[model samples]
Each structure stands twice: as structure tokens, then as C-alpha cells.
Target: MTKMIFLNLPVKDLATATAFYEAIGCVKNEQFSNENASSMVWSETITFQLLQHGYYQTFTTKPTADAHATSGMLIALSRDSREEVDAMVEAAARSGGQADVREPQDLGFMYLRSFADPDGHDFEPAYMDMGSVG
Candidate 1:
């Protein structure tokens, strides 16, 4: 069975990416954080690999996300509560990320907010009360 998940992404600056994830409360894996890439551990099962542009090209044939344009994908993290979702989004902005959405949404049962990293990679933080997952 698959037990681990690796989310590999490209970033413009390794240091900035590292700082952004750290500000969002992720502890980096030192073993994988180096000149070319860094691993941000979100949980026991989730890891985000932020690679330098040159290094990322070694693995994928597709072009990298344009820092000034829209991304083809959006990364999302699930939070325990609406407050947690807001905190993460706020933290991202404080750490050089931008709010992908103008404001957080309150849908009675679910709350969501979006943010984009310095390189323009999109992300979202969502919270759904266990009783509301329908």
C-alpha cells in the first residue's frame, strides 16, 4: 500500500519558499532541504518538495508555473477549524504570499480561503466540521 505522499513543486527562490512554509507552521526536512530543493512536512503522510527552477526541469518536461500568471494547479490544506484556516491564510500573506481570494468564505458548514506563494503557486486552506462533510 502507498504510505507516503510527495508534492513536488517549482519555486523561484529556495530561501523564500522555505520561509513561506515555515511561516505557515511547517517544519522542514533538513535532509532534503538544500541548494536545489527543500521538503516541507505538513503531516506524517504529506510532504511538499519545493525545487529550484533549474532542478525541477530535470524531472518534468512541462514548463514551470509563470510567476506573473495563473497556475495550472492549486494546493490545498485542511485545517481543524475556521480560525485555523484564517490564521494560515494570514500567515501566508505575512510571509510574502498573496491572498488568492479577496476574503474567506463562511458557508455555514465550511470555510475556505486562498493564497498564492511568491512564485504564484496557488493554495487554499479549508475547514469542514466533521458533521458537515456531505
Candidate 2:
């Protein structure tokens, strides 16, 4: 059984991608970080690998998908509170990410904000108060 989860993502600029995620509270795993790649740990279960352009090609034969214009993948993170969700989305924007086409919304029991990373990767930070979700 696998013990750790790795999310491999391709980025145009490793340094910029690393900095963007760092600004949003992710810490780099220096042991696994190098010039062409950086391992940004989100939690014990989640680690996002930011690889330089074309690097991922070495590991997979599949062609890369357009994260912005087409449906490929969406990364989601759960925040502890609405404020935290807002902070993460805002941090992404401040670090070169763009705000989602739809604005943040509150749904009585939950709140969510979506953003696109520098690579045009879609991500969402959402908060669901206990008892509010069924």
C-alpha cells in the first residue's frame, strides 16, 4: 500500500511556482528540492511536486493537458475557516495566480473561493463548518 501521496504538476518556472506556493504557506522539502523540481508539502498526506516544463514528460507518455482552457484536473484544499479560505485565495492572487471567473460565495453552511495558479492550474479553497454539511 502507498503511504504517501504525490501530486505531480508541471510548471513553466520552478522558482516562480515554488515561491507562489510558499507564499500560500507551503514549505519546501529541501531534501527533495533542486533546480528542476521542488517538493512542496501541504500536509502529511499531500505533497505537490512542481516540475519544470517538459520534465513530467520523462515520467509519463501522456501529453500535458491545458489546465486553463480545457478540463484536465482540479486541485482542492479544505481550510479550517472562511477567513483561511479567503487568505489562501488572496495569497494565490498576490503571487501571480488569477481569481476564478466566479467570485467567492457563501452557501450558509460553506464558503468557497477558486483561483488559478501561475500555470493556469485550477484550485479551490473551501470551508465547511461542522453541522452545516450533510
Best by TM-score: 2
How many clashing pairs per prediction, in order? 0, 0
Q: Residue 31 in model 1: shift from native, Å?
A: 1.0
User: What lDDT tens digits, residue by residue, belong to model 2 across residues 5-28?
Assistant: 899998988989999999888999
Give model 1's TM-score versus the native structure: 0.91
Cα error, residue 104 of model 1, in Å, equals: 2.5
Query: Which ranges of candidate 1 are over 4 A from the true structure?
Result: 100-103
RMSD of each: 1.6, 1.6
Model 1 weakest lDDT span, ten residues long: 65-74
Model 1 Cα shift for residue 30 (angstroms): 0.7
Number of colliding residue pairs in model 2: 0
User: Across residues 1-134, which tens digit of lDDT does each residue of candidate 1 receive?
Assistant: 76998988888899999999999988899998889999999998999999999999999888876855765877789999888988998899999999755577788888899988888878889998879767
